[model samples]
Target chain A: MSDDNQHQETFEDFKNSFNYGSRSDLNFKFLKNLSGEDASHFFQELLWKIGDSFNDGDFTRVVDHVNETQAKAYAGVGRFTYDDSPFTPLRAPLSQLRLGLMTSSGHFVAGDDPKPFGVENMSQQEAETRIDDFLKVEPQLSVIPMDTSIEKLRVRHGGYDVRASMADPNVNFPISRLAELQAEGRIGELASDAYSFVGAASQLRLLNHTGPEWVRMFQEKKIDALLLVPV
Target chain B: MEAGGIPTVVIGVHAFRDRLAAMRLPRTVITPHPMGRTLGAPKDDETQKQVILAALDLLETAQKPGKIIDLPGRYRL
Candidate 1:
């Protein structure tokens, strides 16, 4: 095949292999808009980074490359930071402490109707299509009971691909694994309710208001330690 | 939540180490997994359970804030 044909074939393979949602379409369009040479370079770099991960069993390089590209694309956007790190020593032994689970994977119980960021009454497709608008609103939290079946869980995040999490909520929200640990006596107990929220929201709101509110709820439950899974 | 007296540990992907560091969380366990599968690959109950245990270990042992531990493993899928 000619070089042009080869690049086109590779791009086609990439499109087929990447099974993300609407945001992926935006990424595809962006790639399509690039000049032929620029597109080839982009794909080459991406493949190289992916290969590096497989070779070294580390993904930091791939992740850094993507982050750098995104940083360049949104150069002026500010990133969130904190000046202080708060620490509360575990007061009880691991086997005796009541554990709480939380995830930013945007998971909720089926039929719970969690309107993340106040985007109410929209299907998953609608929420994804308007994800940019959703990112601007205050973060919302969903409570998933500890014993909720995996079949009753659903995810609605727009930050990254949610398909893996949709297929298996334990990928990001490992409530079942925590319950198993509790059963094995690795922990004293599991909180009756776990918390979740869409992480791709206004961090200011989460840091100042919503996060504290969630903390208060955990406090009310007398949770001794928490396990947070961020997707 | 650590500020509220409820100790917390975060299980995250290694790709976001800088972002996680900037957040200044109390304890963190960074795993060599993809973005969506922070704990492990889908349906891999063994790896998932191991990741959870690692986080729980950090909760019990980490003495200072901003403690980030890298769980040694590659993505299986």
Candidate 2:
């Protein structure tokens, strides 16, 4: 069939397609917006796509299109950091901070440290008052382009050194130089501002909670770019 | 990084995209496998660029302040 004669299937064409990638922790409402009949039809087609991975090219094209959209639309993006912190007692690292706040208040960044809100150094009255005020950053973290010579974007999945359950993504030399790039101020040149750990395949529980929070937090922060590097 | 923010693009699998769309979050799908593996080939800049560019398309044509677009099909490199 010609492209025009062929019907274009939408996400709604499926009953329960995989919601397992970026924001896997969402309260899904894909079919809720449509009537029961339409929802049924959506699922019908989705099942067809699943049974036959026949449209790989079409899917790839769409993926390419979305990639372009992300670049042109946002001010900047960053990878959700997944490294095991050198700092001991860093509970969940960046994902923890970002997800905890979102799951808790649905408003705070995933990386916002709530520890200061729970400090015993303050009085009860002071502590209670500081709870809300503490979230707002004094001097918010900002992304500035690194003035170093650059050819391409490279990053390690920062978490490989931390989590045992994860794989060693073992990126090339370019990706491995993330720290050097950051130090040289070259990381801020592209759309994504930071490099995220792309190596954790075993932290599904944490990812299910934290990854979504990162996406939500980035949106709230008005971050336009996102990068994930597997170790 | 300590780097300043830039209009970013993330290439993700369709599953992740659907989840985001369901939750009303905004992001683009690269229709690949799970996270971490962008182009399937490790550190292959050529494949990675193709994948990255796919994610960039969403940023380019996103009309409204908030929108979630289902990318066309699966991605292979």
Candidate 3:
């Protein structure tokens, strides 16, 4: 019933206290803005999406590409739209689930004396220098590219800057010409909607985790086809 | 694969996750970038079709419960 009582024991204590102690860690962010149950559902959704989308057939080629691209973008179904009701919260063992992960999330856990994923103790003045240093190895993903002709559309999509990485430079900014092509009701013949590679990923793993769900939803809706345009 | 009721398409900007959405009975992957603009608003029908077609391709090939289909050549299509 108490907040601290959720997992009162440390990994060491858990090891000595419970059967799953080795896998348990104190997830600091786990309780932040999370309704426990919804978080659990989200995790369930992760498994389901992978099951429904990953198969051995014509889609074989797509498995890796979609996983890689999205594993680098999106977040938990990218947060439900405003129109929809929020998800439920359930109390579950998050620490036990992420024990073997390479993720920067929940880096501190299960008696290892976890530290916050990134810089934890830098003065405000040194923030820029720190970010610059981090960018050297952990560079940020640019949502928009430099030579993008779809600048206007980027703004239209509701973003401050449309940046992208040099190798995968498919920003959401579609050119006016492309937009024109989409408006004339010509694209739906082959697919449901044209691609718009503009939006920013909330979390790197979100895209990958939520990918199958997107595919399933479109299919269930009888979309017939999809033509990812990649800005 | 007891993923509940009829088939449903799960939409997300990434493919690594969404296991839960897929389990919601039906599932698929999109591997796009942001979640908000899956269809890329303000664009036209042709542009939207690009997103839709790729989605369709997933459904077409998807068979098992945990499929990870990736249309790397999505741009070409």
Candidate 4:
């Protein structure tokens, strides 16, 4: 099917799931206000909101205040698929496995090598202006090894508040905490390096291409287990 | 790449736990926190360590793949 039809079907499915039992006119009217891309982003955020409330069993209440007929629409698109590599279990004990940290928070330290996003050196205003450009920077086509220490680390992500992470990089990356774990013998060893990149980009090409490539890089470290921290 | 012989686990907020489970990557631990502060509030070493330990524990105790364990606490910005 063409992209237009697929988007229409997606909107229809979202309307059915979200506004069930509501008036058809109201549902279609709300959907009609949205462009195809907006419809997709709405569905994505709506799903995240739903996922947050899944444990409460109060999902019906969550949607009750959506104001179906009067909601404004914006433009953006996102999609997710379930296709993934097969599952692999941790065969070795924690004390015997090597661990690594990978984050989407886009961390770097001063005096380190330059990164793709270039936001680390940009002024706040410049970074904000160039946010979309950073998303296009798929450094190394996957994950890039971060050469940073706790004292030198700085947070450069544009998608979320970076204050917490800047004050203490462990807020997002948790490298210091992980090292403490290693010292305590809670884990065997820490990888010589960690990985980071700005992840709020809406690019599926980077997501799909990075998975296998990330695995290849981590494998070189003989990393027995990995901790994926997504923002 | 869990299927490629390296076991992996994800740490994210409750908002993305379902998709993480659906992704079927491996084990996942959801915390009731914001996106950037996945481990917990900054400077809270004890709580942060606990969160990491909980997720790492799931790496071993999860009976099946795609299991999501909720860390016991709330950290709201």
TM-score of the second chain for every model:
0.93, 0.53, 0.53, 0.86
**Per-residue lDDT of A119 in model 1:** 58
lDDT of 3 by residue, A3-93 (tens): 8758566433423321112332111122222344544444455556566566633443343443333343333543432222212111122
Candidate 2 lDDT: 0.34
Q: Which ten residues in a row have the lowest lDDT in candidate 4 chain A?
A: A69-78
TM-score of candidate 4 relative to the true fold: 0.69
Distance (Å) between predicted and true CA of A117, model 3?
Answer: 38
What are the lDDT figures for the candidates, one per model?
0.77, 0.34, 0.32, 0.67
List pairs with backbone clashes in candidate 1.
none
lDDT of candidate 4 at residue A160, scale 0 to 100 = 60
Model 4 lDDT per residue over A51-152, tens place: 878977666433432322122331222255465446787887788888888888877656553444543466534444456776676643223344346777
Q: What does the lDDT read for residue B51 in candidate 4?
A: 87
Q: Candidate 1, TM-score vs. the true structure? A: 0.78
lDDT for position B14 in model 2: 42
Residues A29-105, candidate 1: write the lDDT tens digits: 33433445655676688899899889888877665555344323322313867777879999879898798888888
- Candidate that would win on DockQ: 1
Clash count for candidate 1 is: 0
After aligning candidate 4 to the native by TM-score, how far in Å is the CA of B62 from where it should be? Answer: 2.5
Which is superior by TM-score, 1 or 2?
1
RMSD of each: 7.1, 17.6, 19.0, 10.4
| Of candidates 4 and 1, the better by TM-score | 1
Instruction: Point out the worst 10-residue segment of candidate 3 chain A by lDDT.
Output: A98-107
Off by over 4 Å in 4: A1-78, A83-85, A113-120, A139-148
Give the per-residue Cα lDDT of candidate 2 at B7.
35
